[model samples]
Structure formats: structure tokens, C-alpha cells
Target: MKKILLLLTLAICSWSVLHAQDDTFKKYRENAAGKLKKAENDTTNRLWKKGATLSLTVNQGSLTNWAAGGDKFSLSIAGAFSGFANYRKDRHRWDNTMELAYGYVNTTSLGGRKSDDRIDLTSKYGYQIGKSLYASALMNLRTQMANGYLYTDTSDIFVSKFFAPAYLILSPGLDYIPNDEFSLFVSPITARWVFVLDDSLANVGSYGVDTGKHVNTEYGAYLTANWNKKVTENIVFKSRLDLFSNYKHNPKNIDVYWTNMLTMKVNKYLSANVSLDMIYDDDIRVFENKNTGVLGPRLQIKQVIGVGFTAVF
Candidate 1:
């Protein structure tokens, strides 16, 4: 009987030990699963990001008596806004950006004139295919916010206005993004649409649209390269180059747009900015000389420098 009791006791102890080990393993597994879920949620939340920067610059000068033959009274004001939103989830990514700028200058000799105007928006969606490479589709829109004019001694000729020369481009391409500082995109098939909403401008066949037509379409190949880098702790540089070739007409005459900017930050609220822009389009004509009455395509260039209040968020 004692031997049988000892055997029963040993069996009972074995059962209890096995039960305890099972419970411990179950709790450990549950804890590990909870931690994994929390980590996944945190990663998902970090996939989306957004930021923006806004700047305003103002300058004024007055002279009671000046020997340099400059404007007696002069004032200039400029403002710019740039913003971006980006998302990444697994192999998919989306990026959107908007940029706006406007400037005005007034002097005793020139009166009030617009010195700069721009509105640009871009959105790109991409799926990763290889190392640092993606299959992407991009949409871009460019236009002006206000009336643009050519200043002359006698009169200011109305040249362009809001929506009068809006451009929309759509492309599906391959993007090569080696790092955060540079990217290149190329598309063999691209579509571009030009809109001249103003009745007068459409009637004059402005911006490559047919006479009296409000819209023009073209099939082309597009290429764009972008670079953004911090040259120093307080300085940044950004540049972009865009090229397009129409497959249907004048393919040899490619359109080009190049922009560059340098920014030096003084603090969280102050900065200095310099920008240069160049554009060339065969369809746009410029008057070379009024006396000769010659009109032809020409390269356009603009530069701006300013020190101003800036905010980034």
C-alpha cells in the first residue's frame, strides 16, 4: 500500500509541474504578441509626415538728395510658401508639394510693378521595384496667381494673367532616388496640356494654343532632375531641371525649365534667400526690338535676392 501511495504521489507531482510550465509558456507568448502589436502601430504612425516653410521679405529706401542717380523713393515686398506631405507604407510611397511666390516693387521712376509670380504643385506616387528605384506616376501643375505685364516707357503691355497660361503635365516613369539629396525621373510617354482661359489670350493664340482655342494637348517625353542638400549647418541649396520633347512636332526643339535656390538661415525666424530661374519655349515669342519689329523665341532669365522673416514647420 505504501509503495502504491508513493507511486500515486509521484504521478500527482508530475502533473502539477507540467501544468505550471504550460501556464508560464502561455503568458510569455501572450506578452510577446502584445509587444509586437504595439511596435507595428508605432511604425504605421511614423509612415506619414508633413512640413512647410513660409517667408516674407520687405525693403524700403528713400533719399533726400542722391548723387548716384537712383530712385528717390523705392519699396519692394516679396512672399513665398513651400510645403510638402509624404507617406510611405511597405513598398508604396506618395509625395506632394506646393510652392508659391509673389513679389512687387515700387519706385519713383518705375512706379509699381510685379517682379515675380509663381504657383506650382506636384504629386508623385511610387512603388518600389528595385534598390533605390521605383515605378512612379507624377502630376504637375504650374500657373501664375496674378496678372503679368511687360513694362515699357509709355505703357505696360498685358502679357499673362491667372490661368491664362496654366500648364498641366502627367507622366508615368521610372524614378531613381539614390538618397534623400537627389533624384532623377524619366518618362518615355508623357502628356501635357496647356490652358489659356482668358478669351483675349485664346483669341491671340497665346501659349501654343490654337487661335480661339482654350486648350492644347501634346504627347512628349519628359525628364526631370532634382537636388536638395544642406551645404552647411545654416545653408541649403536646391535645384531642379526639367526637359520635354514633343513627339509630334519639333522634337528637336526641346523645352527647358531650370530653377536654383540658395538659402542661409540666421535663426528660426530670419533668413537670406537667392534664387535664379531660366525658361525656354519655342512657342513663346519675345519682341527683340521695337524699331525692327522682330519677334522670336528667346531664353528668359530672372534672379532675386532677399533677406526676410521665415518660418518652417
Candidate 2:
């Protein structure tokens, strides 16, 4: 009887060991299957690819009264069409981007009927400086077509002349992003030189008498801040502020300006924007009159509301 009990105990021990081994094998198989499925899904979804965007904007506005008279108020309409294609590698680097934009505007003011058109071509190369830091440089070629008249008084009239000016600007800047969607950039130096393709407008001064050849080489500093927040799955809030100052040959002849824009993204395909721009020029004010010379601060303000369609590919 004692021998029989010992044999039964040994059999029970063997059965328990086999069951444990079987359970361990089953778990290993399940884990391996899960890993294989994940690998297949990753292969099917290609997350690294190139993208493109096309956009259009239309805007209209009027100026209210304070001083300077021709028409008590003015009507202006403007539109812009832009497109870009870029190849993104990794999270913060891109090789290059091809950007093209065309803009046109028409204005009827107290001064007279005015119109302007511009074509801009830009190419950019970007590099990642660090985890949340990026550096980029852009080359731009711009051509402008303008026709207008400036009325100093009821007696003084300046005729409109059709002219086109072309220039190339080189801009390099660094960005500091604390998070995924917020960034601030401070570029202490930027240089802009006009090639002087055409000298038609150089010798003619409508606002003041021609005082020989005026220099137009501009060197400046610029600062920009951008914020992007997701309001919903399909909506977003975007805001940007850009400030710049140009110091030319004459220190007092500097130009200071600021532009602020807020955009509400209705969807991936549509958005609306409100923008404000201000420009102050010391030289333009100094040469206001050919004889007396009114030298001081000159200010101009602009406000606009616009709707646009944007597409990304």
C-alpha cells in the first residue's frame, strides 16, 4: 500500500510540470503573434511622405477720415493665390520647398485710382538645429507692377507711371519651439538690396521734387512669434506677429513696421483671417513737399478681413 501511494504522488508531480510548460508555450505564441501583426500594420501605413499646399485669398476694405483729402473714403480689393510643395524627413527637417505666389490689388481713393500687382517666387532649405530648434534660409525673387497718382492739394497733381521693380532677398533665421506648436524667432540681422533693374521711378518723385539719386539699400532686424492651438478636431487658432526695422544710409531715414494676423481654421480646406499693418517712414515724411520740407514721422494704417481656401496634398 505504501509503494502504491508513492507511485501516485510521482505521477501527479509529472502531470503538473507538463501543464505548466504547456501554459508557458501558449503565452509565448500569443506574444509573438501580436508583434507580427504590428509589424504588418506598420508596413502597410507609410507615414513618411511629401506634402503640398494650395491656397487663395480675397479681401476688401475702406479707410476712415482723419486727414488728407481726395475722396473722403476709399475702396480697395485684393486677392492672392499661393502654392507650396515640400518634402519632410524625420520630424524637424526638410530638404527644400518650392513656393509661388501672385497678388493683385485695386484701390479708389481720394488721391486717385491706384492698382498694384506682384509675383513672388521663393525657395527654402531647412535644418534642425536641436530637438526643438530649427534653422532655415530662403531666397526670394519679387516683381511688382504699380500705377497710381498722389494728390497733394486740389492744384497739385502727380501722374501715374507704369513701372516694374525686381529684387532678391536672402533671409536666414532660427526658431525656438518650446512645444510642438508654439515658436518664437529673433533674427538680429537681415539684408535687402534692390538690383535696380529699371531706373524709371528712381529719378521721378511724385510726393516731392527729384533730389538726385536716392539710395535704397536696406539692412534690418526682424522678430517673429507664432502660436498654434487646436480648438477642436477640425478647428484651430493661429496667430503671428512680425516686427522689423530698416536702417538705411541716414539713421533718421529708418523704416519701422509691424504686422499682426489672426486666423481661424474652419477646416483643412478653408480659413478666415484678420490682419493689421502699420508703417512709419522718416524719409518719406521729410520729403513730403518739394520746397518747404515737412520732416517728421509718417504713419499709415491698414486693416483687412479675408476668407481663403487651403488645400494640402
Candidate 3:
């Protein structure tokens, strides 16, 4: 009887220890699951936000034995895309944006021509320094997608091509953001590199690059301002302005780039857009006329108006 009791007592002690260990493991698992569920439910801790907008406009016209003095058949298509990805956590922030636009037109008279082409990308990182202020670093790239030509009465002249005249700018600056709709960035020390990858253009020293060189470097002061706002329930406006003054060259002649876009939402899928772009680079030379045979710097302007299908994502 004593031996049997001793054996039973040892068995009972082992079972108790096993049960206690299982309870402890169950509690730990429950705690971990609760923490994970809380983290999943909390959107305030989300680190990244992204959005994009797309627009496509198409125009077609046909003339059937009509004396309107127009092309027999004409078609034009324009597409634009804008997107942004932003991250914010604690005092650190990162923002990236991309914009692309291209347009093509084909007609009986003009044959085929490119109306517009643009590619722009920007990335910025900042650390909060004070209320509505940040110490930031920014990098920007600007280029075109296709070859550009200058049409003349005699013949078309080859001008720019993909990566032929690309601009890359890097700056460490201060950004002021008092509101969500507007921001201004300024930097006294900025480095800008102009790349002319085409051998022909580089040989001619196009776009301020040295003769026979593919890249030109400049030290400059840079300023950029951005604004985006809803003018009304259906209308939205966006604008950006950039200015740069080269310290090694003619600092008095500042480079200017400004663009404005106004969008009116007609419905969920239809919209109207008006865009204006202005640029002035002292190094960019333009031919005055065929007769004058003079090339000089001039202000360039472009305006576009269209109604198109719009999508947001």
C-alpha cells in the first residue's frame, strides 16, 4: 500500500506541473495575439500614403469635301499621369512624386507631329526642425521621352531626344510648410548637372554643356514654390515655380521655370484641363528667324486646353 501511494503521489505531481506550464504558454500566446490585433486596427500609425491621377484626351476630325481649309483627317491624343508616395513617422518624412505627359497629333497636312513630352521626378527627405519647418534634402530629375524637332519652312531640324538634355538638381535646404496646400523650399548651395548624352548635341555644346562633353556641372542658389488648392467644389488649381542662379556663370541671369494647371471636374469620368508653362534659361538659344539668322536666348511658353477622361487611384 505504501509503495502504491508513493507512486500515485509522484504521478499527480508530474500532471500538475504539466498543467501549469500549458497555462503559462496559453497566456503568452493570447498576449501576443492581442498586441498584433491592436497594431492592425490602428491606422494612426500608418507610415505610407500614396495616390495617383490620370488623364487621357483624344480629338478627331474629318473633312469630307468641305471647303473649311483644314486637314482631311486629323487625330490627336494626349495623356498625363501624376503620382505621389509619402511617408511620415515621428519627425522623419519622405516624399516622392512623378509626372509624365506625352501628346501626338497626326493630320493629312502635318503628317505626324509631337505636341508635348515631359518627364519629371522629385524626391525629398526632411527632419522636423521646428513648427511648420523642416531641414530637407531634395533631388529632382527632368527629361523628355522622345525626340523633338524644330519645324521650318525648308525642313525640320533635329533638336532634343531622350536623355539628350536631362537636368538633375540636388540641394540641401529649408522647407517651410504652414499649410497642407502650399510649401516653399530655398537653398543657397545647390548642384545642378546638365547631361547631353547624344554625341551630336554634345559636340555642338547644346544646352550649356562644354563642347565634346556629355555633362555640365553648375553651383547655384535654388528656390522652389509649390501650391495646390481646390478653388471650388469642382475646380482645382496647381502651380509650381523654380528659380536658379548660377554662381560660376552669369548670376544675374536667373533660370526660371513655372507651370500652372487648372482642372475642372465635369463628372466622375470627364474633366477639363488648362495648362500653361513658361521657361527661361539663359543658356538655351533660339533662332530668331530664317531671314535674321540670329540665335539668342528667348522666353518659351506653351499653353494647352483639353477635355478628357479622368481617373484617380
lDDT of each: 0.93, 0.56, 0.94
Q: Would you give me the overall lDDT of model 3?
A: 0.94
- In lDDT terms, how accurate is model 2? 0.56
Of the pair 1 and 3, which is ahead by lDDT? 3
Q: Write down the RMSD of candidate 3 (Cα, Å).
A: 3.7
Kindly give the number of clashing pairs for every candidate.
Answer: 0, 2, 0
1-313 in candidate 1: lDDT tens per residue?
Answer: 9999999999999999999999999999999999999999889778988899999999999988677778899999999999999999899989899999999999998899889899999999999999999999999999999988877778878879998899899999999999999999999999999989999888988888999999999999999999999999999999999999988889999999999999999998999999999999988874466677787788999999999999999
Q: Using Cα atoms with residue i matched to residue i, what is each candidate's TM-score against the true structure? A: 0.87, 0.53, 0.88
User: Which one is best on lDDT?
Assistant: 3
Winner on TM-score (1 vs 3): 3
Candidate 2 structure quality by residue, lDDT tens digits, 79-118: 4444444445565443333444334455564433433344
Q: Could you tell me which residue pairs clash in candidate 3?
A: none
Cα lDDT for residue 50, candidate 1: 89
